[model samples]
Target: MGRILLFNKPFGVICQFSQDGLHPTLADYIPVPEFYPAGRLDTDSEGLLVLTDDGQLQHRITDPKHKLPKTYWVQVEGVPDSAALDALRAGVLLKDGMTQPAGAALIDTPPGLWPRTPPVRARKAIPTSWLELTIREGKNRQVRRMTAAVGFPTLRLIRYRIGAWTLDGLDQGTWKMNT
Candidate 1:
């Protein structure tokens, strides 16, 4: 029988089980053996990471051909104007290639948001804003690059959902098993 685990990965934690010397890893939080992450989240990012013992299920979630829509709440260094939002929705050019069109919008602070440790750097002169972005492709540092391409650098990124799964009730560094 296949099993699934939804993990709420905290910021600064590595996704891998191996030790990297300074940062904590999934091994510290998830005690389950043989389960592998369906996808990866950078150490700087925070939110849901789906893990499963089934290879096929992992492929579906991470494979480009499946196009599983992933949603993120991004905090950026500057407020995006309509043109910028349009650019994002229309797909921004990246070093890898032009990204697929994404669902992009400016949003107020996310409700029930947890504060990041050592909170984002603030500048009284430079303003920050939140954006909700959904994309089907997973590229390296894609969200950060996308925001930076449109004149706003990502300050913090939180993956809120992957297809039907969400970070809903999971707190930071917690995991729940789905049998």
Candidate 2:
């Protein structure tokens, strides 16, 4: 069997193995050679990222046709009401087209959450809320667009789990091999 790695990527880290002159890349944290990212997370995003040495495993995880649901914990600009939740659950329209229906629910921020390095802009008038969203499709910036379409813009996006793998014990910029 080939090696598999689960990492809790921190904000500001690029998903690529090598940096293009500037900015930190996965190479700064993941030491495993010949392993490639199974999927991608934006530099501004954080949380679970998978790496694998097996090409087959890589395809299985990255291919949207396989329909492995990705779960995210999102902080948005406003409290989402039932209508907004329903809109998200029912599927929101994007520039690409209508998105697949999603599983979304209001959630409390877990205790002892580490703050983002450069925190989100504070607004005295607008409050924020956390939401858990699970989606089967992988579209570019889909989650951010979806929430905005439903009247709540995402303030922070963190992928907590992917398929059966999670970032449970992993800390920012740390990784562990799954035997």
Candidate 3:
């Protein structure tokens, strides 16, 4: 059986195992060799990231044809109204073209989230809200762009789940192996 590593990536950590020289990368957290990230999360994002050594498994995980669902807990600058949520469900137009329809809903910041090291800046006058967004496509920075398109700029983004795997209780910088 091929190996799978579920890493709860922290903010500022790059997805690659290579040395970036400026910031921490996956190599700092995982010493296992031969595994590659199935998908990517931006350096500014946090939470679940799947890695695998099997090329076919990796392709299935990241390929749009498989339609694996990815869920994110997004902290946005403003509360999204019904229209905004509907737009997300209906697919928002983006510079790359229209995104596939995604599941979007307001949620409380997931109950046991690890606090961000530097922390998202707080604006005293503008309130931020949490959104749970699930999308099938893995477009680069899609969640951030989608939220922004609907007038709610994402202040922080944490991916909570990918397919059937989840961060669940995995702490930041830690990883769990599966076969």
Which sequence of candidate numbers ranks them by lDDT, best first? 1, 3, 2
lDDT tens per residue, model 1, 83-173: 9999999999998899999999999999999889969999999999999999999989999999999999999999999999999899888
Model 1's lDDT to the true fold? 0.94
TM-score of each: 0.97, 0.97, 0.97
User: lDDT score of model 3?
Assistant: 0.94
Clashes of each: 0, 0, 0
lDDT of each: 0.94, 0.91, 0.94
Model 2 residue 80 distance off true place after TM-score fit, in angstroms:
0.4
lDDT of 2 by residue, 20-118 (tens): 887789999977789999999998999999999999989989998899999999999989999999999999999889999999999999554678988
Residue 22, model 2, lDDT: 72
Model 1 ranges with Cα > 4 A deviation:
none
How much RMSD separates candidate 1 from the native structure?
A: 1.0
